[model samples]
Target: MQKRYRIKREKEFQEVFAAGHSKANRNFVVYQIKKPGQTHYRVGISVGKKVGHTAVCRNQIKRYIRQSLLELSDQLPGDVDFLVIARANAKNLDMKETKTNLIHVLKLSQLLLEAQAE
Candidate 1:
């Protein structure tokens, strides 16, 4: 994902956590809030030490999660700030499974912009 589409500041993350709504599954907790007058979606991904003690492991998890979101970015709605937080169980998932799980959760939360079958 591009830097423009990422949530980089501590205050932004805190705002999303405090005001956004959330949804969770076995692997991820997703928080989102609609930002009025914005034109794009901003994302944040978190893979903490609880999920993986080693830095490499945590970074790998973050990479895969961001990759998954990148693939699904076109389908997501704009003007939203969203965060995906990894759970301990997320360590067991590979890139493909991580993408699948993340997509499923996004769909469940109705965050993705549904494509019309024309």
Candidate 2:
């Protein structure tokens, strides 16, 4: 994902955590907050140590999340910020499963557009 599309600062993450609405499934937690006037959505991803033992593992999880977001970008709301937190079960998932699980969580949060639900 591009830098402009990522939530990079601690304060931004906290703001989303404090104010955003959240939804979760077995593998992911999704938090979304509307940012009116913004032209595109931004996302923050977190995969804790409990989910992955090492930096490489954690990064792999992040990569999966980023890739999924890239593919779904056009289907997501342009004026929202999303924070995705990975759970322990996520570590074992491959790319397809990661995307599936992420999509499920996003749908639960109503972050994905209606026409994109398929």
The C-alpha RMSD of each candidate to the native structure, in angstroms, is 2.4, 1.2
Candidate 1 local lDDT, 57-93, one digit each (tens): 9999999998988888788888899999999999999
In candidate 2, stretches whose alpha carbon ends up further than 4 angstroms from where it belongs are 115-118
TM-score of each: 0.94, 0.96
Give all candidates' CA lDDT scores: 0.90, 0.93
**Tens-digit lDDT string for candidate 2 (34-82):** 9999999999999999999999999999999999899999889999998
Kindly state the number of residue pairs that clash in model 2.
0
The residue pairs in collision within model 2 are: none
